[model samples]
Target: MREFLQRTLVWLIVILFIGLAFWAFSGPIEGLIAAGVALLAWLGFHLYHIALLLRWLEQPTAERVPDGFGAWHTVFMTLYRTMRSQMQSKRKLTNVLERFINAGEAMPDGVVVLDENDRIEWINPMAMEHLNLDRKHDVGNQILNLIRQPSFHAYMKNASFSQPLVLQLTQPRELVISVQLVPFDSTRKLLLSRDITSLERVQTVHRDFVANVSHELRTPLTVVGGFLETLSDMEEVDQATLSHFLPMMMEQSRRMQSLVEDLLTLSRLENSPKAVMAEKVNMQDMLDTLMVEAEGLSQGRHHVRLEKGCNQWLWGSAQELHSAFGNLVSNAVRYTPEGGDIVLSWKAEGERLCFSVKDSGIGIPREHIPRLTERFYRVDRGRSRGNGGTGLGLAIVKHVVARHNARLDIRSEPDKGSTFSVIFQRERSAEPEAQPENQA
Candidate 1:
């Protein structure tokens, strides 16, 4: 629209020039012509004045802002250079500004604009959302004062254009913010923040896992070595002495064994998508074998009760289901005292198959039951040692159940014993072809 007006003014100025020339050259011809020419000259001069105003409006910013002295003069030179650059490229200044603003808005990271007084001048939508900023109250507030974090304030207070301040948002979100201390004019600063919560979480879990695993292994290893040395140099190698120390040795060895197995299982489970299973399994036969093994392991005092709710042919990994079912039954027996009973049962719940092993042993506390599947977690450390438990039994069961697209649920009270269940998402439970024994 301004371009059109500018061209119109130029045309008006041209018409005025023609009229002025006619009045000045045709003077002796006619009074009416002379009067007409005078009127045209007056209109032309005014139109020319209008042209000057249009030209001023049309001038580049570098030309419009008059040159000042000293440092101010340097700004004009820089502005002139920018103006020349823009002109050389034949780009619209308004378009450039629009693109810049659009890019700022489109950024995924949070961005903030600060004025000379270090107050937040403007913030992008991401900044508002990521920082949980209240647009109503946050704007016009000092960035340093409002964000009360010492890290942020210090960054702002001691920032240089050469070095950007990168800090984490101290808020619960723990967002990673990389702030560019872009100094525009004497006081404005631009801050950019990107959320790294997920990344930080993954890194933290990795660190914890490494530290925990290392700590868990170190103690057992020290015991195993220390006891070996003591056993070797003992003067009296009698049955009574051997009996006392042998059990402790076995306990330490077993604990180490359990830790190693768990480490291996965890490693294997964490591998690629080939963690697969597709086979026919008779859960009854599987549970029966598991029962037999559990009884043998516990010496027959564990009376296991079995009830089948599905005779359908289950399809999945035979080994994984076996391990999962075995873990549930074995774990039940392990926690159950000598005379306690373990009940192995299964059913088809809607479209999914559920296999359960319940016990009449010492039950798990409500709090401890939640972490029952965590690697190396134990309800009673003493009881776990007495039972020769690796604490990876449930963890193994969990990963197996997950591979089968199933979920494991544990229900227990502090003293009434516990019921560990694996809800199989597979379509059906496999039936035993021959009469498979169920007395593990």
Candidate 2:
């Protein structure tokens, strides 16, 4: 509006000056003619500016705005400023959108965006892997056609997304995904997916653990109950019957007790914090004690020997190490046949120290080696039970080894022998104790 007034005032001034000049130099008729000519010239000037404005509007960029004279200069400058501000706002919005997309790409969970028609608008990298989607090909396609799960299709069609959908995918590897739909922008939706495979596995392991514990206890309880019932029924029992039933009941009771102790040990190891390594374990004494225990457990069946190749003590809990080492030694004695060799050795290899039990026992098969550390896992269940094994020995050993930052290696051959070694790193081995001074 201001530019319009300025243009009108300029035209009136030009006409008035031209008319006054003609009136002073000539007459009234000549002055009127001069005013008409001035009006035409003023129209021509405005037309030329209009042409420049129209040409610049073809591109409509701030940099391309044409220079103008008189009122048109102010109009061009205002137009340039408005265009520049809009461009800056557009660049800012573009940057924010890019950041949002980058965040989705970096997230561990999957994210998918769907338009009003349930067509794929954008999908993150994880979502592509979870749903088997191609960014180039799958975009703009209906998500239902790609997912193809009946439950998922029904979920979208119903639009009742109160609960997340648990989907088990077989292709692109077996995966368990928790999928949820969140509506946004009144029409569009965000599809979120999280991998819950590990959680599901843990829950399955918990259920199996409970079932196994129940099954293990029931047998011993049933045996004890049966014997008690028999004793009660027999008012005058014979000495032979008493001798047969009493020992059997005692053996089952002892077995149950062992199982309970092992379970408690495992629970403590799992729940307790790391073992304190301030106490230095005397490896020589510990190895000697293990040898004696192995011999006792052998009962003059297999020959047991201890090889003390290194005098270095260990920096760890003495009680836990004793338990771990004893378990391995006893297992060797129990499994080895009569006249077999059982050697318990403590030696240093380079910067590491190793405690190994090598026995000529019924060695494990190759396939069972990987799962030997799992609780209640036995290569030969019947043989293991006959030998009075609790099946939690290796699992306990594994935990103890881990607590001390050590590694347990097992090597075996069928019917030949098996060697179980616990290797401790340099950090775990302490220097040999100093000898007494000459003064004594």
User: Model 1 segments beyond 4 Å from truth?
Assistant: 1-108, 160-187, 232-247, 367-370, 426-440
The candidate scoring highest on lDDT is: 2
Candidate 2: C-alpha RMSD after superposition: 3.1
TM-score of 1: 0.69
For candidate 1, lDDT tens digit of each residue in 38-96? Answer: 66775675566556446545775645744434333454466678777877666677778
RMSD of each: 9.2, 3.1
Tens digits of per-residue lDDT for model 2 on 1-440? 58868788977997999998998899988998998888888889889989999998788998998898778888888888999999999999999989998899999999999999989999999999988899999999999999989988888877489899999999798999999999999999999999999999888878877877787788889999999999999889999999999999999999999999999999999999888879988787787788789888998998888888889999999988998999999889888889999999999999999999999998989999999998888898878878888888999999999999999999999999899999999999998686568722
Show pairs that collide, candidate 1.
Answer: 291-440, 292-440, 295-440, 314-430, 363-417
* Model 2 local distance difference test score: 0.90
Ten-residue region with minimum lDDT total, candidate 1: 65-74
